[model samples]
Target: MFDFTPNPTFGPLQNPDLKVPTAAMDAQPETIIVGAVIDAISEQRLPAGAKLGEQALSVLFNCNRANVRRALAALEAKHVVELRPNRGAFVAAPSADEAREIFQARRAIERTIARQAVKRIDADGIARLKASIAAENLARSRRDKPAELRSSQNFHMLLAELAGNRVLQRFLAELTMRSTLILGMYAREGHSCAHCDDHTGIVDALIARDEALVLDLTDRHLRRLEAELDFERPVAVTVSLKDQIFGS
Candidate 1:
């Protein structure tokens, strides 16, 4: 149900007639395209299970099919997209069961990170977290929901990094993206103001080196977020075929 019309100010070229010279190719095209795609997905500008038509992407990004494939492959590796054989690629649609499993997994991983972070958190780590929180507060104040939501999510990833476990950190990063997508698909508005406060509590506990309290706070935080979603409705499959066929 997301709109795909090109924004006149910064829209991707819609079916440009000129070919991009391979010799003068921009290696950063994939990165740029992927970032935009990710932002769209995060904001629910692209809905769950929506088809990411390769031809459309090629035209949108003004890149060739080859680069579009590469970018999509990367997104797939991150579990952000599912590549079906003859059906082509679509934004990943996580099942209800998968959503529960992801939240449970996040609880375990985030709690562990919180406990570990308390033991090792330094001045720099605290500073970074404070900056993240400040940014979240600013976003909330300005009613920038996307920025607030992304910042709130990034705070957890920052905690994982503070824990200094590269393996766990990488896993959390990927899971975080998938979790955001799931929330966008299912979560209701005015779910909880606790998201911001939970983050503040965790930071306080970390600063105080209260490992046990940090673990408890993180567990509760994850549970509170899970409770916000209206999962009773069946997974939404509301993409428009016309929009897919003709550039919107």
Candidate 2:
């Protein structure tokens, strides 16, 4: 059964009958709440299929139920959360096929970005990529999985930004978030290559303005990541309801 316990911040109003606060009625709430929810999911602090209790969220953010509803509606539009008839909002749980499709789409998008980025890449952009690579190396040395993962992900995002296509960048951001969630659900521990040299190869190709080489390296990198995924079974796990509500 799905757990729907309220967080401690909303403890006082655990009762559905309790009235929501009126203070948040006058201001904007959608952006803040949506960001919080997304951050929670991305960090794996909130597990897949966990219920997003509107009342608890309202209290946690010090907003009214109306604003909380608006935030959830926004998440629904992003496909980050789904609304069930009797179950309310829950984090999206992607199937194995869907996960494979997301990676395929990501590879296409990123490969295109890498090709274009080679022509438009500047010294500053190259420096940023170098910094990201350095950060990833540091994280690997320290054995910090989260940091290593984020740094590797940011490298692709930096490439997209360098391509100077805002629309592609936006879409890539959403796709990357979904990919991260899929990885969290299906990845094996210690499976990621934290000290990946593939990124450096892409950067080198970009510096040489070799679009073909850049695309080839990007495609190979993504394929390597996909090969690491354990798809034989779903690895989804239930997180503590208390930790979900009141994060450390």
Candidate 3:
């Protein structure tokens, strides 16, 4: 179980009035469901270990229980959600060791990505980075933690995209989702360590084509986020699975 406040960023999935296009729904109901769950997790509106009931998800997504089952199985494969033998699905709650390892792996992957991104980033890439950072700043200014978190995650994902390596981009996406779980479980502040200047500094380094500085800032930024978590005393909040997804 988990508790969640409304997050505007989940508009498409949460809005009952918004209908899915028939062709897209027919083509990928399971994939759409999978993306919704992952987005909830990544936004931290869905906490670690929150039960993902098939019936509830089916109702929310306007799909069948079988589709929900398939979606949960797909999430299980990504390691962001777990399916117990009899207990059904819950978000995966990584241990402190796993949390550490996740960051370590992120650092390695992102360092390579940062190097590549700095080398290849063009004017358009720089503009996109600024737009993302501006969105993040606006969310933070409004105290919209969920939107802020999503924007913060997107900033990193953008870097992965700019890096031009599909494999590393995919890996970073998964790692970022896992990091959300880690933050939900262990963060003392109940949000990310995404200070405004942290991203700005990284972008500046990218603009200047200073690879070494970018790497150092990126590593330190991640390490600072990791340090903010209180692993020994994991904290969790409870809410209805439906509320967590559709926002109450």
Candidate 1 local lDDT, residue 195: 80
Q: Which candidate do you rate higher for TM-score, 1 or 3?
A: 3
Task: Name the runs in model 1 displaced over 4 angstroms.
Answer: 1-28, 241-248
Q: 123-220, model 3: which lDDT tens digit per residue? A: 99999999999998899889887788889888999999999999999999999989988887788856545556889999999999999999999999
Candidate 3 residue 209 Cα shift, in angstroms, is 0.5
Residues 1-248, candidate 1, lDDT per residue (tens digit)?
A: 75656433123233232124222445577775676666666545566777787777876777898888888988888788899888878889888888899988988888788878988999999899999999999998998876787788779889999999999997887677778888877888666655898888888888898888989989988898889888886655435565546634
Question: Which pairs of residues collide in candidate 2?
Answer: none
Q: What are the candidates' C-alpha RMSDs?
A: 6.3, 7.0, 5.7
- Candidate 2 lDDT trough over 10 residues, lowest sum: 14-23
Question: Candidate 2: where are CA atoms >4 Å away?
Answer: 1-27, 237-248
Q: lDDT of each prediction vs. the true structure?
A: 0.76, 0.76, 0.81
Give the candidate number with the greatest TM-score.
3
Best by lDDT: 3
Model 3 misplaced regions, further than 4 Å = 1-26, 190-194, 237-248
Q: What are the per-residue Cα lDDT tens digits for candidate 2 across 15-78?
A: 3222222224334677777766665555455556677788777766788989899889899999
